[model samples]
Target: MFVPFLIMLREGLEAALIVSLIASYLKRTQRTQWFGAMWAGVFIAAGLCLALGIFINQTTGEFPQKQQELFEGIVAVIAVLILTYMVFWMRKVARNVKAELEDAVDQALQKGANSGWPLVLMVFLAVAREGLESVFFLLAAFTQDVGYAPPIGAMLGLATAVVLGALLYVGGVRLNLAKFFKWTSLFILFVAAGLAAGAIRAFHEAGLWNSFQAVAFDLSNVLSTQTVFGTLLEGILGYQEAPTVSEVAVYLIYLIPALLLFLMPARPAASATKDAREASSARR
Candidate 1:
């Protein structure tokens, strides 16, 4: 539950940031008359995302056990890839996101007078990217277990993001977005590692992997998934009582270099400071 909550919170906040930037830019430029189109784009993207999620869920619901496992494995792999790319992509663009959005709006408005399609297209593409990413993540999360907690956690996280976005927009709160994203990205790396390990397990269950089925070690006697804490860990970190040797290997192989690269300190601290200041100024 906590894992899904955090995932949704981060993704939702990213989308919120984009939308807030667009809205704020429009207001500052005295082009607020197109707010309706902005909202319409958002709603359309959201609706499409929801529909796609529902379709995928329903389509997979009727699969046989083996096919279900295969599907889960596929979704997990896709989630890991997407999450990894998102982490790196955001790290590269976090400093210039606001400026880029403002520029996009400027270009859109300049295309033609009384032309709102550009704005709509821009918002739709931006929001839809986040929405589609969230859908994949939520699907991967739901594949792990059967419970109501995941959905509840996702809803609460999204609500919190909306509230935080509103606070930021109204100047009621301030945040160091750089620090927030840095920590969350670290956490997400671990989560992705877990998903990768789980994907290997799912493939084994689907009978796609026959070798390396040897149990690395069994901890079922000490802490079974049936236990409360074990269940929570399993949900958040893909804890396995008797994980396969391959699973452990895959987890470490992906996590080690990824962590090192992600945590690598910037070469020039001065430039980082300048970028941070620029980001702050853009936010203002």
Candidate 2:
């Protein structure tokens, strides 16, 4: 539940930031009349994401047990891959995101009053990317365990992000977004690792993976998965009382290198920080 909460928080914040930037640009340029187009794009993107997520969920539910495991395993792997790429991609591209978005807004507005397609398309694509990413991650998260907590957590996270975005836009609050993302990225890395392990376990259950079937360790006596605390750990951290060798191997392989790369310093990061701070200030 906590993992899903953070995932939604991060993804929702990204979408909110995009929409906030577009709205800020529109207001600053005295083009408030075109606000309808911006909102249309946001709604369309959100609706599409919701539809896609629901369709995926419903389709997977009709499968047989073995097929269900296979499908879940595949989706989990895809989610982890996408999550890992997303984290690194954001690290690489976040600095330029503000300027690029502003540039896109300028282009969209330059097209003028004859049609709102330019602005609408721009905002739709921007928001849709974040929305779809969230959908896939959430689907994988929901597949991991049986419960209502993850979805509830996700809803709360999104609501909080919307509020935060509003506060930022209204100049009611200031945040060091760079630091926030850095810390969150670290947490997300662990979450993705857990997801990967779960995927391996799922594959094993589906009979698609047989190697390394040996139990690396068993803690069921002390930490039974049926317990509330154990369930929480399993849901959030992919904790298994008796983890198979392959699961542990995959977890370590993904987390260690991913963390190393994520924590490594980038060249000339100070300038990027300056640009991000300037952009954040301008959004107000």
Candidate 3:
């Protein structure tokens, strides 16, 4: 649950920041009249994303119970791959995102009416990237937990991000965005590891895997989901009362590397920030 919220929140903030940058630039250049078309494009892309999400949710419901587990297991695996890629990619490439975006804007403005399609394409691609990431993550998370909470988490995250983004734009708040992204990526790494393990367990249950299915341990006797701490663990980290050997193996295999990468040295976020600033300045 926390994973979904955090993932969506972070992604939403990225998108919000991009849109805000475009909007602000338009206003500054007295091309504010283009704002209406920009908003319309944004809304259209958003609506399409919403429809796509709904379609995915409803599609998952059509499978038989056990088959659903198998399908979910597969989807979770896909989610793991994509999520892991995103974490590392961002670590390596996030700094120049702002500058790359600014260059696109400059090119579009230079073209005038030809800019309309480019603007539409840029907004669609940015928001859709975020939306696609959210859709896959929710699919994976919802499969692990039994309930209505994942969707609730996503909505909460998106709403909260929007509020925070608006405040940042309106001079109502300030955040160390570099630190925010760095820390949150670490959090997401843990979540992805849990999904890796949980999905493996699901596949075993669905008859896809047969190795190392022994019951690793049972904690239900002492700690039940009915208990507060138990429920929190279950929601936050996919804790199970009686996890199988394969589940534990998959979880740790994913967790250990993810944790190491997150904790290990990488290029400083400040360096990325500096590079981005320099790039933006060069463009200007």
Candidate 4:
């Protein structure tokens, strides 16, 4: 519950932040009239995302056990891919996001009298990117356990994001957007990696891929998914006892590289500040 909530909050706020940033930019430049269009894009994107989640849930509801397993495997792999991409992409773009957005808006409005669609396009693309990402993630998560928790988690996440987004716009909260994304991206990477392994497990169950089917270890004796500690591991880390060799391999393979990549400093300290300033200046 908490996990999904936090995910939604972070992702949701990120989207909200994008919308707010554009709105603020327009307001500053005496272009407030098109604000409604920006919002229309955002709301429409969000609705599409909701519809996507619903479709996944409803579609999987009728599958047999084997088909369900296959679906889970596919969804998990996709989740891992998207999450990993986000992790790397965030690291790469953290400093330049503001500049990029500002530039985009600038280019859009440069058309003068006919800049409305361009502005709307920028906001729409940004918001929809986040929305589609969230939708895929929710789909993967919903298939994992198939209950109220996933949706609840999503709602909680979005709710938290709303609060944070409001706070950010109001000029009260002090946020280090860089480090915040770093840590959360790292966490999300691991979660996605675990899901990736779980995906492998699901495929094995569905008899899709049969490579390295041996059990790495039997942790069931020490802990079961039903146990308190086990539940925590499962919820946060996507742990499964008696995981096959392929699962373990995929999980570790995904984690080590992702963690190292995430931890790798984007810039040396001596130059990072200067870069950040330059980037910020470009945006301003």
Winning candidate number (lDDT): 1
Alpha carbon lDDT of residue 213, candidate 1?
86
Residues 1-284 of candidate 3 have per-residue lDDT tens digits of: 67778888998898788788788777766777777666766787788878987887798798887898898888888888878877886776566676667666666656756457667776777777777777788888777766778788888999998998888777698988888888888877777777888888878878889999889999988998789999888877778888889899888998887878767777765665666567667755
* Decoy 2 TM-score against native: 0.91
After TM-score superposition, what is the CA distance of residue 29 in candidate 2 from its true location, in Å?
2.0
On residues 107-167, what C-alpha lDDT tens digit does candidate 2 reach at each position? 6867855788898999999899888889889988898866898899999999999998998
For candidate 3, the TM-score is 0.88
TM-score winner between candidates 1 and 2: 1
Model 1 agreement with the true structure over 150-252: per-residue lDDT tens digits: 9999999999999998888878899999999999999999999999999999999999987898999999999999999998889998989999999999999
Clashing pairs in 1: none
By descending TM-score, how would the candidates be arranged? 1, 2, 4, 3
In candidate 3, residue 159 scores what lDDT? 93
| C-alpha RMSD of each candidate structure in angstroms | 3.2, 3.2, 2.8, 3.0
Which of the two, 1 or 3, has more TM-score? 1
Candidate 4, superposed: residue stretches over 4 Å from native: 267-284
lDDT of 2: 0.87
